[model samples]
Target: DAMVIQNPRYQVTQFGKPVTLSCSQTLNHNVMYWYQQKSSQAPKLLFHYYDKDFNNEADTPDNFQSRRPNTSFCFLDIRSPGLGDAAMYLCATSRGGTGLTSSYEQYFGPGTRLTVT
Candidate 1:
């Protein structure tokens, strides 16, 4: 089945080291999104790509960056890993753009758990 996939389900990085999480999908969706979930807290929308356009949430930190090299793949880069940055990074895809008539449903990958030491 066509779905989103995240690499290296688990990752460990030293403090101040850079780490990258990846997501790829076979669905050929037009929109892709990245989210950060810490423990029981709600998932925070870091940013998303609608086709080639990049949109970042107002609250998303500068430490969080994303790259969509192409339609089927996206990358999340953390310039400097910190203990507080450890969390489950989620990658999701949706068929339609944000609109009243467009479907808002999103399919997500299992997620990559990042641990900072």
Candidate 2:
């Protein structure tokens, strides 16, 4: 059951408005990361939480925020999604347990395609 899932695969929001995206998993993994990917570009890390140790990517904008209320779920909130926020939001998960050699191999969800008009 190591799978990541995202809801509302597509979202349409007005410019300078707020939006929230959700993710959940049955993997029981302790590390969860959120990534933003623009058209044809590599997924860029927005932030990650390693068993409550939150790590934010330096380039992530203030408009982007995340929350991990529990081990199985996480959320991405955009305070004011601009036109530039139009892209794909990918949620990924990985194990944080010892002896897991491939803990870094992230498993991504189908992703939410956001369109900011």
Candidate 3:
């Protein structure tokens, strides 16, 4: 099985503040994804990485991502977090796909819970 790791289990931030979340994988999969999940809602794909290429959801704004193969890491940057941004940030990795949407066995990290004041 692939291993995905996320740092800092919990986070607290003030409204309009910027925050960064990170994820790293040992599998070195070609695709990586970031998701935002609410208390009882399904996870929503924020963006994904295919190697150095990034695919961001069209509706997601004020979000950015970067890849560092040297560390097998992907970082999610929320430029200005709002109350709505208070959610669990999930990091997942997959072996191969035309796009992340078509991938399988997306090994997921435990996630980082973000709280907005």
Candidate 4:
């Protein structure tokens, strides 16, 4: 199945608390990403690992980090979840085919909605 799935669809976190979200895929893809999307706004690219190459969005906050030790699993770690971190965290993956035109399309997970006080 070519799906990126996240667990616990909804997560409640306290202010300044830490949380971890998990993602997994069966696509055998080489690229995976984490995005943060707030209410009624465009999703912000957080970070991603393209195989062994790590790429981070310049605007992503320092509190957000990600790890992908292997091909099938990835994790997003929020060291200190603040109110501003309350948003929908989306996981995505892309198969390495070619240039942007061939491999740029990303498949998204159901997403985990984080709530912070």
- lDDT (0 to 1) per candidate: 0.94, 0.91, 0.84, 0.90
Tell me which residue pairs clash in candidate 1: none
Per-residue lDDT over 1-115 for candidate 2, one digit per residue giving the tens place of the 0 to 100 score:
5689998899999998889999999988889999999988999999999988889999999999999999999999999988888999999998866674546778899999999
Ranking by lDDT: 1, 2, 4, 3
Every model's TM-score:
0.94, 0.93, 0.86, 0.92
Which residue pairs collide, candidate 3? none
The candidate that achieves the highest lDDT relative to the unseen native structure = 1
**Cand. 3 Cα-lDDT:** 0.84
As for lDDT, the candidate ahead, 2 or 3, is 2
Candidate 3 residue spans exceeding 4 A from truth: 64-71, 97-103
* Candidate 4 lDDT, 8-103, residue by residue in tens: 799998998899999999988899999999999988899999997889988888899999989999999999998888899999998866765457
lDDT for model 2? 0.91
- Going through the candidates in the order shown, the clash numbers are 0, 0, 0, 0
